[model samples]
Structures are given as C-alpha cells and as structure tokens.
Target chain A: MHTLREIEERARAAADKPAPYGSDLDLAAYIDEAPERSYVDSLEQLEELGEEELARAGVVKSGRQRSGSFVQIDGSVVHRKALEKGLEILSTREALEKYDWLWGYYWKAVAVDSDKYTAAVEMGPYEGYFMRALPGSRTIYPLQACLYIREPRFVQRVHNIIIAEEGSELHIITGCASEHRIQAGLHLGVSEFYVKKGARITFTMVHNWAEGMDVRPRSGIVVEEGGLFMSNYVVMEPVRSLQLYPTARLVGEGATARFHAILVAQPGSEMDVGSRVILSAPRCSAEIVSRAITKGGYIAARGHIRGEVGGVRAHLECRGLILDERGVIHAVPELEGRAEDVDMSHEAAVGKIAQEEVEYLMARGLSEEEAVSTIVRGFLNVKIEGLPPLLEREMRRMMELSEEKAL
Target chain B: MDTMRLGLGGGDLEEAREDKETVLRVEDLHVEVEGRRILHGVNLEIKCGETHVLFGPNGSGKTTLLMAVMGFPRYRVTRGRIFLGEEDITGLPPHERARRGIGIMFQRPPTVRGVSLAQIVALCSRDGVDVEGLAADLNLGDFLSRDVNHGFSGGEIKRSELLQLLAQDPRVVLLDEPESGVDMENLQLVGRAIRKLLQKDLRRRRTRCGLIITHTGYILDYVEADVGHVLCDGAIVCSGNPREQLEGIRRYGFEECARCTR
Candidate 1:
C-alpha cells in the first residue's frame, strides 16, 4: 500500500515527461506482471504505471526514429501528434510563444492505468483522459481523461488507448481547461483510434482555456467493417490560436463516421477547426459540421471529404459568423469523389449584423448591444441544438462569460 | 381627431428623470456622413405634441435627417443644436438618445433570426408591462413566439414596430415611411397602434408626441400630422403646417420647391 520507491518514480516520471513517442503500443499487453489495478490506489502503483508507460513510449520513439520523420511545428503552420496504441505521451515545459528552443523540456504523457477505465470513484489525475485504440485489441468501457495547462509550455503531447472487442460499444469524453489570465501555454496532443467490426465509438472533447494559449490537437480514426466513430469537439474560450483536424478513415465496408465542431472566438482570439473523412471502403458514409464565430478576431476553417469508393455517401458543411467589422472569418469546403456512384456536397457563409435589422430591435426597446447579442445567439441556435445536454450548457455558459467581458 | 397630448407628468423613468416635454429645437444644424456633407444650416422647431411629416424623393437626405437626429455614428453634426426640451442631445449616442425618449421605426425592420417578437417586447416593456394586451393591439398575437421580423411579411414588420413603440412609451415616435408596403388591414392595425401609443400614459396619464416621416399622405389620413417639413439634400427645403406641406408636396411634388428651398 505504501512505497517510497513508487513515489520517487512518479516524481521522476512527471519531472521528465517528454513529447509522446509511440503512436503504436499496446497497453493491454503490459497488463500482465504490471502493478495490480488496486495498486493505483497506492503511489507505488502510480509509480510503476508511469514508469512502464514512459518505457513503452520509448519503444514507440524507436519506431518513429526508424521512419524518416522529424517533429517540426511553429507559428502559422499547425501540426498534431497521437499514439496509435500505447501509454507514452509527449510533455514539454511551459515556454513563451516566441521561445521555440525550449521544446525539448517537454515529455509526451499518456494515462498508463487502463484498469481504472470503469472505476466509478477515480483517484488522483485519472478522473478523465484521452484514449486511442490498438491494432487488434478493443475496449468496451470508454476511459475518461483531461488536459490542463497553466503556464506557457512547449509542444506538450498526450496519447490515449481505446480498444473495442469485435462487437463492443464505447463512449468517452475528454475535457481541457485553464484559468483565465494564466501564463500562456501550448497544448499539442493527438488521439489515434481503432474500431473493430461491429464496434461503436463516440469520443467527445470540451475545451476551455485561458487567453494566450495556442492548441493544435489532431486525431485519427480507423474503423473496420460495421464499425462507427463519432467525434464532437466543443470549445468555449477566447483561445489565441487553434488549428485542429480530427480525421477518420472508413477502411471497412458499411463503416461510418461523423465529426462536429463548434467554437466561439471573442474580441481578440483566433480559432480554426475541421473534420476530414476518407472513404476507403465500398459502402461507408461520413458527415461533418464546422461552425465558428469571430466577434473580434478571426477563424479559418477548412474541411475536406473524399469518397474514394463507388458506394460511399459523404457530406461536409462549414458555416461561420463575424460579429464585428474588424473580425474576420474564412471557410473552405472541399469534396473529391473518384467514383461516379458516390455522393458528396458542402456549403459555407459569413456576414455581419444588418442595420435595418438592428433598427427593428431598437424600435422594440432593446439597446443596440443587447439586440446584437440576441441576434448572434440566435444565429447559433441550430448549432447549439445539435450539442449534447452537458456540452450545450457549457456553450451557453461560455457565451454568457463572453457577454460579461463585453460589458 | 381630438387626440394629441404633450409630455408625461411624472417623477422619473428608469432612464429619463423628467418627463415634461417642450418638444425639439434645431438651430443652424449641419450634418455629414462618411466625410461628405448632408444637412446644410438647417433650423426648425416642433410643439410638444406636433405630428411632423418629412417628404422627399429617395436619397434626398430625408432618411439622413432622421438618422442624424438618432445619432448614428455615420452622421456627424458639424454645427448645430438639437434639444429635447432644454437638454442637448446632439452629442449623445443612439442608445442614449433612445433612453431619453426618442424612438425610431425603420422602413426595413432589422432581421434578428432567433429573437422572438414577444421576447423583445417584454424586454422593452421595462417595468412590468402588459405584453399580452400590447400584442393583441398590434395584431401580433399569433406570432408571439416567432422571431422579430425574421420571416414576417411586410404588413407584420410595420405593425410589430408599432407595438414596440407603444410598449417602449417614447415621448417622440419617429416613423420612417410607416406607410410603405403596408396592406389595408395592417395599415389600420398600424395606425391604431400609433393612436394607442400617442394616448398611452407612462404612469397614470400623459400626452405622447408623434413624428411621422413619409413621401406619401396615406399615413396622414390615419395619424394626424400637425406640421410637415420637406428635407432635401440633407436640409429642410421647406416647412409649413402638415395640412399645407402634405397637399403642396402632393400637388407640386418635392422636386420643384425642395431644390429651391435648399
């Protein structure tokens, strides 16, 4: 129950966290001889998992070190990283946005305790988490995770593991947040998922961070025959800059996936998010909705859907609003089908509040500001309607907070 | 119709403290928009309860005159005095002017897609207003839950604006082309809404003022205008009793005299 070595190990592990190295490591294989699930209740268990996760993650790095690929990310050009099946994640220390040289202090960190996936009463740090899937192993009880950054940091990375048995169904929710006015930080993480035939996977992420934070989170989905993957990303913050592309590949016939993203950028923030689906199977379908609001800054969204198979049906939509004159919004929707029998389509629009419309509200006794806010909130009615109960409340709270800032 | 009154005699409003009305006074008013001149040395005055009609062709600065009074950022008064009673409103923002009892109805109501007509009316009602009765008067009872003018027909926009004016209880209700695109039934409903507004008391009882802007006299047959001014090229080209200018503009049109007066 108590071990000084475990505490020291966990401290050393947390101290030396680096960028995630493995996109392919099976945490399930290490389940044997590994610390018992009960040990997680003890620091010793944590020490072992953290150590094992770090070591296995090194194996992943060796795999990448074999490939002719190197990690290079910076301003303007967004990037992402993920673990296909492992416990190792990249973690970087906080660094200034202009300080690119300090990225080496980061370590890729992943939750190593897969046994706590269904533990109703979670202990220290494992309350919630991001997860990925293995090549052959699948999970039924989706794991929970969270990511939080308080100070300027380098390319911090995280990896997740989610495996569904041949016909298992799972739902996982990941949350990320930081207090307002906290020192600016960076979060660059990724999730790689594998869904077996007849399995269903739904991964939801809600992100709210303080200003000065720039995030580029990338995710990849590999769905087998009769599998399903639905992804929803809801961001409620005035993030300085964000570029994310959560992607899915329909590799087996009758597999389907859907991606939905909603982000509201207040007076001086920028947000960019999209979903890309590639149909590799003969009869797979994908649908995506990308919505952004630029009240004072900018948001650029680019979405693409490629129906490479003859019987695939895919739809992509990108819609956004610019609430102020100085605010900017850009949307790009693309669809490419190699087969004549496939169906694909996309649409986008951006605009400001109309004068006559404002007058109409003014005559009704609402002040110009109130009128504009009402109109804007109304415009998001459709997108908000599509959100789940928990996320919808969070979105509404974020809107109210932004309005308070305006006041 | 023996139905015009002036100023609400009260202690205070949530925004305006004193409700007594001495009407508007404009002297040597000069207004500009987007770095270009519009109103050129215009002077005018209105009695507390006078009904004024502004007549001019499109883009003759008729709308600009009203817009200038509303304090739109686009229009700047280079030299002028605009007073509500003795209070100078020239430097005030649009909302500030509104808080002081000046309300305007646009020719085209602003479209706010998810804001319900009823929700806004309740917001305007300010202090425990009877929204149900107000909706009934403007014939907007059926569309209570519908967003303000999002999918409203032409008639509905006009009448709904009237309902808001009544609920807001502004001392001066400036109607911009109130007769445009109004159907026969809505014309009656809109007129009746104005009539009720002109008579609605903020508390207990008080007379309300009405300023109707138009290029046609159809609104005159419904709401009586005490005086009328011909606004051309940003300045009032001519001024006279509503009975005189309404008929004069109709007979001679604003083209002949509106140019000469400026």
Candidate 2:
C-alpha cells in the first residue's frame, strides 16, 4: 500500500484532468471568486445561519445536537463530541495514521485521477467524516453529521469513509445544504463504505441547496458475506444542477443491498440521479428504486442491475411524475445477466398526473390544487421495509412538508 | 324491514319534510363531450321529497344528464342553466357543487394509484362516519387498505362506489346505471344500498331526493321511484308512473312510446 504522502501526491497529479462521466456542466462561472474561509466561532454563531432552517431542508426536526455528533460549516469542523462506546469518529487526516492499511488501498476502488472534482477531494486539504463501528456491537441511534455552506461563489469538497465491523450494526444520517440566502456555490462529495461479514449499515443522506449551486457526488459500497447495506437519498430544494451515480457491489455469497431515492426538481434546476448494482457472487441479491418529480425543470432517473454469477437476483424500478408542460422527465433502466441461472429485471415509467384522477378527488370535496398535491404526495410514497420507526416517521413528515412546498 | 336504513345514518324520512319544493332543476340543457353533442334541450326537475327514475336504451344521453348536473368540466354545457334549490350552479366546479350537497356515483371510476380506499373515505367522510364499519357493511372490509378501485371485480367496484357515496352523505344523489354489470349477489346488495342512499323507506315522505339512470330497470324493484321519464335520441319522449311506464316499455318497446308522444 502507498503511504499517505504518496497518496496525496497522486491526488494532486489527478487534479489536472476532468472526469468523463455524465453531461458536461460548466463550473467556471460559479468558482470565479476565491473560496470563503470559515468565520464561525461558536455554535450560536453557526445557528445564526439557521439550524432550524437547515433541519427543515432535509426534513429533520433538529440534528443530533447531543453528545457524540459531528458538525462542520464551510470546510471547518465546528463541533465534534467525544467518542461514544464502540464507535470512533475521526477526521480523514487523523484516520490516515489510525488505519494504516486504508490509505492508498481504497482509492484504487474509486477513480481519483479521472476528473478535476475527484482530484480536488483526493488532494490533501479535504474535510470529512471517518466513522467505524467496533465488532460485535449494535447501535440503534444514528451518528449525525452535517455540512453547511454560508458564502457565495464558494467551492466545498469532501471525502468520507464508513466501516462496520463483523457482527455489528450502525446507522449514519448526513445533512448537507447551503444557506437560505441567494448564493451560488459548487459542492463535490466522494464517499466509500465497507461492510464486513455479518455486519449491517443504513445510511440516509438529505441535500438542500440554492438554485445557483452545483453538486457532484460519487459513492461506492462493497458488502462481504452475510452483510447488508441500505442507502436512502433525498433532494427537495432547488439547485442549479446535480449529477450523481452511486454503485453497490455484492462480493460475497448471501450479501444484499437496497438503494432508494426521492428527487424533486423545481424551476431552473437540472438533476441526473441513478443507482447501479453488481451481483458478483452466488446467492446475492440487489434492488434499486427511485421516485422523481419535476415541476418546471429537467430530471433524468436511471437504474441498472448487472448479474455476473449464477443464482443471483436483482430488480430495478424508476418512476417519474411531471407537473408542468415545460418540465421534462426521462427514465432509463437497464438489466444485464451474464450467467444462465441469473435473474435480472427492470421497469420504468414517466407520465403526467391523470386528469380523471384529479377530477375524481375534486368531486369528493377537494379543491383542484389539493387534489393534485395529495396525488403527488402519494406518488412520492415508496415503501422500504425494515426502516427504524423514528426515522420512518421523520421521513414521512418531511414528505408532507414537501407536499406543501410542491403546490 | 326498513330498506332505507343506511348503516351510517338512521332517520325516519316521513317526519323530515312535507311538500314538493324543487331541489334540482335543469332547463333546456345542452351538453357536448369531445365536440360531439350528447344531450340537447333536456329539462328535468326533482322535488325535495321525490325520487325520479330515468329509463332509456343505449346511447340515449341518460348518463350525460347526470354528469351535467354534477358540474363535470369535460361535459361542456354549451347552453343551459342548472339550479340546486334556487342556487344557479351552472358555472360551479365539481368540488363546489359537492360542497353544495351534489354527489354522483359513476358507472366506472378510474383507479387511483397509491391512494387507499380507506384513506379517501376518511378524507370525505363526516365526523360520525365509521369508515371501517361502512366497509364491513358493504362487504369491502378486505379492500379498505388497497388502492381505490384497483384490481377490483365488477361487483367490488360497484360496492366501492356506493361506499364512497354513503360516506359523502349528499342531499342530492345522482346514480348512473347502478344496476348494470352487477351479478345477482351484488345486484341485491347494490339495490339495497341505493335504496338506503335515496332514503326510500320513510313511508309517505321521501326527504332525500335522487335521480337514477337505469337501463335494466332492475333497480326499480328495490327502490320506490315516484316518476319515470323515457329518453330517446337525446330527448325525454314520455313521462308517467315509473312501474306502468316500465311495463309499457317492456311490453311494447320504445317505438310505441315514441308513437304515443307523436
């Protein structure tokens, strides 16, 4: 494995090239000014940017402000409580020495030199969370982390890692957003996850940004034998543009992964979100589902499932609802099976709300707007079993709040 | 046994009202759907304590009249006036009409995805309406959690429609072909439900008014309709006692009624 210094040098070397992934998004206009420095001194001062407002953006009441939490604002770590039992929360740089084998070993799984954004995060000066759950431990409460943007024309880049040891379970909830004020910014996020044998991890991420902001997030996960990984992503606020394609690879027998997302694109926003799953071992299974709504913007939802070994199963579904004539929604689904005994399938649908449905609700005493809003709320309801009750209730409440905002 | 004893409500209609006050009136109504005229120069009036039955063959514009009265947007009233108890609701939207106590039971309602039958019933039901109890009453207990009218059998769909009508508790009920496409078992259940909905068991005074459209005339056996009108080719050709007119049509066919009108 390469040393930390050598890994940093490789990241610096890769910063010269641009990533060749999705559609080209021009970042020159937003990054013209020098990035703003963190000026927040206390948690109270950070709250002035409005913690309640930030919480509402992600449908959270208030973040876990209690003990054992990590809060960062504008590339600065504001407050990080002491470690809890069986849990370790460290900064990426500090983790370099703590886990010697993790330095240059994981970067090989993710392409750092492919683009400028990844390279920016890859180089030395990034701030993110490095969390690990000790073996044979179970934690029901989620370890909360937050990242907030307060200045205009600023570029924020981050890299995060999370690992669950064998026979352990953990949940991590992350909230990322910009200040409510009208400010343009760019955010590049890279996350990697590892689930050891017989371990489980649930990750929930919520993003809220201004219409002038651009976001590019790349994530990857690998699950060992008898392990499980579940991910939920949501973005309800308006952003200039966003592009993310996260993947999960089941590398051991009896491993499973499920991915779900909800995206709402308002006026002047463009979003491309997708999930890919690779079943590489026998008796492994994967599922990906997404629900997207576009009011007057552009949204493209994609899902792909690939089965490389026999006796593997996968399912993918993508559904989109367009509210305005100017709005556009595209559904792209692909299923590939290489082995004869593998089972893979996918489904995609894109359409406007039925007029008859609106009328039917209206005839039952609901106004036209209420009828439409109710249907949109129902359309966004995608059921994912095994969620913790509290988290599920919070998600539902946020969906209701989003319904009001949608109308 | 009282046939009009709705599971959701129990009131003697005989003591509720007295006299023939006009509850709904349509004058020279002209309606077009998809640029094709379906109802032309049609007039109808139902009193506060009366139930009117409309009899017609296929494509006779009976359903169009009911839709026009309920203020459906697609059924454009090119020239007409609709009055609900002296209120000119000609330009009202469907919800406003519903708020004014006008409700309709569609022959075939479109299935709504993700909205459960129980959820919708709860949305429109009054405070006293027992949604689960009503579901049991309609034999729809197993369907309460399912999507509205989705994957339901013909009988189940009709029963579901009646279940919603029962929840709305409207003053003026408009039923379109309630007896059609229903099997024997469901036909009895649907007929009884419609009788209760129209408040037909309260002896001399039928307090709640209704306008029922039926092609089979099977619903006539369960509900006591005071007046019957025969419609043919977009016009009401004759009017008389419902049973006698039904008998006349059944024995002599609609041509004889047309000849009598001429």
Candidate 3:
C-alpha cells in the first residue's frame, strides 16, 4: 500500500493532466472558498434549504423512511446520523480521525492520478460522507445523503467511501443538487465502493443541477466472491456540462454487477456519461444498461464490458432517443472477451420515435402531444432488478417530477 | 348476374334514408395512399343497430376504406366527404374522430416497446371501466403488464384489439379483419367479444353498430350482419344478405364477383 504522503505527491503531479473524454474546463474559473455553513443538530433545523428543493433532489425532509441521513452544503457537513444499528455514517474527515486503518482503502480502488478531477478532489480541502454496514447486517430502509452546492461560482469537491462487509446488505440513495438561483458553479465528486465476500450493495443517485452548473464525478467499485453490486443513476435537469464514467471490477468467483442509467438533456446542456465493468474471475457476470434522451442538447451515452477469464459472461445495452431536431444522441457500446470460453455482447440503438407508434396511440383517444409524452415517460422508466421497493418508488417519483420540468 | 343498381346519388340518397337513423355515411369517397389512388367513388351507409360486412380479394382496397373512414392521415381523402350523423368529419384527425365515438382496430398493429397493454386500455376508456375484469373475460389478464402487441400471438392480438374496443365503447366500431389469423379456440372468443361489443345479444333496443371486413366470412357464425357489400375495384358492386353473398362468393369466387355486373 502506498503511504498518504506518496498519494498526495501523486495527486499533485497529475493536477494539470486532462481526462481522456469530455470537454476540458479551466479549474481557475471556479473559486474554492465559500461562506462556511454551521452544522445542524437535525435536518429540521435547516432553514435555508427549502423542503421543495430537497424533495426535488429525492431527499425526504422528515427523514421518516431512511435508516440514516447525511447532508453537506458546499464544503461543510451540516448533518450526519445513523439511526439503525450495525450501520455507521460519518464525515470522511471524522472517519479518518477515528480510524487509522481507513488510509488503506483511500485511493486504492481509484487512482488518485487518473485525471485532474480526481487529483483536484485530493489536492483541495473537501468533505464527504463515509458509510459502512457491519458484517451480517441488513438495512431495512436505505440511507439517504444529499450533497448540495449553495454558493455561486464556487467549486464543491467531495470524496465518498462506502463499504459492505461479509454477509451484509446495504442500500443507499444519494441526491446531488445545487441552489435554484445559482447559475454558474462546479461540482467535483469521487466515490469508492467495496463489497466484501457474500455481500451486496445497491446505490441509487439522482442529480438535479442548475442550468449553468458543471459537474464531474469519478467513481469505482470492487466486488469479491459471491458479492453483488448494482447502481441506478438518473439526471433529468439541465446542466451546462456533466461527465462521469464509473467502473466496477468483479475480482472474485461468481461475483456480479449491474449498472442502469437514465439521462435527459435539455436545451443548451451537454452530458457525457458511461459505465464500465470488468469480469476477471471465473463464473462472474455483469450487465450495463442506459437510456438517454436529448430534447435540444447533446448527449454521449456509452458502455463497456470486458471479460478477462473463461466461464465469465457480460452484456451491455445502450438506447437513445432524440426528441428535437437540433438535439443529438450518440451511443457507443463496447464488449471485449479476452478468454476462449468468455461470453460478451453489446447492442445499441439511437433514433427518433417511430411514426407508427405515435399513430397507434392516437387511435386510442390520446392527442398527439399526450401520446408523445406517454411514450417518453415509458422510455425513461427502466425496471431495475433486485432494488428495494421504497427506493424504486422514490426513483420513480423523482423521474416523474423531473419529466414535468424537462419534457 | 344482373346489376342491382340502387341509385346512390349525392343529397338524394341522404334525403331518401332517415337522417336520424344513419350512423355513418360515406358519399362518393375516393382515397389515395402514397400518391396512388386506392378507392374511387365508393358509397356506403350503416344505420343504428346494424352491422355491415365487407368482402374483397387481396389488394382490393378493403382495408383502405376502413382506414379512410378512421381518418388516418396517410389515407388521404382526395374527393367526397364522410358524415357521422349529419356532421362532416373529413378534415378531423384520428384522435378527434376517436373522441367523437369512432374506434378502429388495425389488422397488424405495431408493437410499442415500453407502453403496457393496461395503459392503452385505460387511455381508451373515457369512464371508470373494470379493466382487469374485461381483460380476464378475454383471457388476457396475464398480458396486462406486458408491452402492447409485443411478441403477441395472432389470436392474442385479436383478443387484445377486442379488449381495447370494449373499453372504448365507440358508437361505430371499425374492424379491419376480425377473423383473419385466429385459430379454432380463439375464434370463438373473438367472435363472442365482437358480439358483445356490437350489442348483438340484444334482440331489441340495440344502439351500437359495426363495420367488419372479412375474407372467410367466418365471423357470420357469431354475429349477424344486416348487409354485405362486395368491393370490386374500390367500388361496391353487390349488396344483399350476408350469408347469401358468402355462399355466392364461395361457389363462384371473387373473380366471378369482379366480372359480374352486380
């Protein structure tokens, strides 16, 4: 394992390097300092953040149905709690001060020198959430976390760590958003997940950014023997530019991973998002699915699945819909099989809605506009497997709410 | 065969028939699809509490007439007008016509990838209808959550169409081919569903009407038709009892029907 000093040195060396995908943004354009926010004893004490704003980002104001809750505003941690037993929720800074062994997991799954965004998160003063489930413990309700940007022209950097121990199951819902009035801002987030042997984890994220905000998030995951990892991501509101490509590696035999994403780009917005999974052990499997819709902007939806050993299976699917004449959607799905007995495949489709489909709905008493909206709603609804019922309902509600604003 | 000419002229025919009783009237209708004329000067009428059957050979424009009456944009009504109870609906779009008590079932509907059958059924219903009960009656309760027309069997498709029509409860139901691809088992279900939709079980006070296109005339076993028209070259050449016309066509075939003056 590399020392913390060595990691810092590596991050500093790669601070000027650019990522391979997406347009480059100047880091100097955003300020690092903002007005510090005082910590709140409970979420109800948050007077500045409106209930409607929190609800739009899939955060319950009362925290009635969540096992735990975490709230961070700009660079400060406002609220953090763990309501259930066998669960730990704390700020990364606090967790590091409490446990010295956490340094082993830091920057282990994700390279600190991968790109400038990850490097910036390391080199800058940032605060994020750290959640963990004890061995053999299962959460009844998912934990909820909100990372909000409230300052204009400020860059909010965060790094999160999540872990599920052996025979344990954990579910998390993370909502990322900015203030309604803020037009120009930046968000850089780095997340690392570890699923131990015979463990399972499901992470669902909803993004409700402003029209002129730019976001860059880097995430990585590792699954051990007989473990499972599933991720569901949704972004429906407008953002000036957003780019993320999270990867998961199944390193133990019989491990599995699944990733599903729903993305919508409004006018003047640009998004480049993708997911990749690598199967390195025998009998491991992975699946990636994405649905992208462009109203009047540009979107690049991509997926990649690699099988490196025999007896492994993987599949990737990407579907895109262009709703406006000026809108553009590009789907890129890749599959690679390095072993003889490995099975991998990919399918991608990008086009406009069929005229016949529109007419068929019209014959059923729907106006042209109503039919189109219904179809769009159905297109955005992707049924994820093995998701908790509450999380599924919350995701649906968020999608419907955003559909009203975006469509 | 002698030509049985019922003088179907403009304005005079409307005057001759009871205007209140006529549910649908097509006056000298001509239709074009993709810039090619398919129907030329076709005249037909269906009254309240009556069902009409149309028979024609392959590519004889049997489906075109139903599509034109349903107000599909691609059917392209080039000449003449269509009236639903004295109100002209030639320029209205399909959804407007559907809202105005006109519903049609396609021969081969496209499969909608994510729209479920239950959703379409609910959309078609204007009032609170028992969707699950109706689907159960059609033996399609298990298919309610599935995508519309996705990988459905021929019989299942026919039953699904009937289910939608039942929910719609339109005043004039246009069925392109009700018995085209159904099997022995599902044919009875489809035929009975059509009977229920057209209100054929009632011997008196029946207000619903239907216009069905069939090649085999097998639907006659369940629902009785008041009139059967043989469309030859896009024009109705014969009009009489449905069973008699079916027997005549069976004996002489559509070639003889086209050659006959009637």
Best by DockQ: 3
Worst 10 residues of 2 chain A by lDDT: A59-68
Instruction: Evaluate candidate 3 by giving its C-alpha RMSD to the native, one decimal.
Output: 2.9
lDDT of 2 by residue, A1-407 (tens): 34556667777886666554455655565442344444443344554446576565442334342224566666766655434688887766678778886664456545676577777777535677778888987765777677777668767777888888898887777778887674678787888888889999888788878888888887888888989999888888788888988888899898999999999999888988998888999999998999989988889888888899999988998999998888988888999888999988888889999999999888888999889877887787777776777667656765665556655
Superposition TM-score, candidate 3 onto the true structure: 0.96
Q: Residues A1-407, candidate 3, lDDT per residue (tens digit)?
A: 35888999999999989998888989999999998889888888898688898887778889888999999999999999999999999999999989898888898878999999999999999899999999999988989999999999999999999999999999998899998789799999999999999999999899999998999999999999999999999998999999999999999999999999999999988999999999999999998999999999899998988899999988898999999999999898988888899989888999999888888888888899998888888887787888888888888888888888888
Share of reference contacts kept by candidate 1: 0.54
Q: After superposition, how far is residue A180 of candidate 1 from its true place, in Å?
A: 6.8
lDDT of 1 at A119: 13
lDDT of 3 by residue, B116-198 (tens): 99999999996888889999999999999999899999999999999999999899999989998899999999999999999
Per-residue lDDT for A136-174 in model 1, tens only? 443332333445443344233343334454676555555
In candidate 3, the residue pairs with backbone N, CA or C atoms under 3 Å apart (3 or more residues apart, or in different chains) clash, namely: none
TM-score for chain B in model 1: 0.85
Give model 1's docking category: acceptable
Worst 10 residues of 1 chain A by lDDT: A68-77
Estimate, for each residue in B210-259, the C-alpha lDDT of model 2 and write its tens digit: 99998878898888887788888887777657787889889999888777
Candidate with more favorable, higher lDDT: 1 or 2: 2
Determine which window of 10 residues in candidate 1 chain B has minimal summed lDDT.
Answer: B1-10
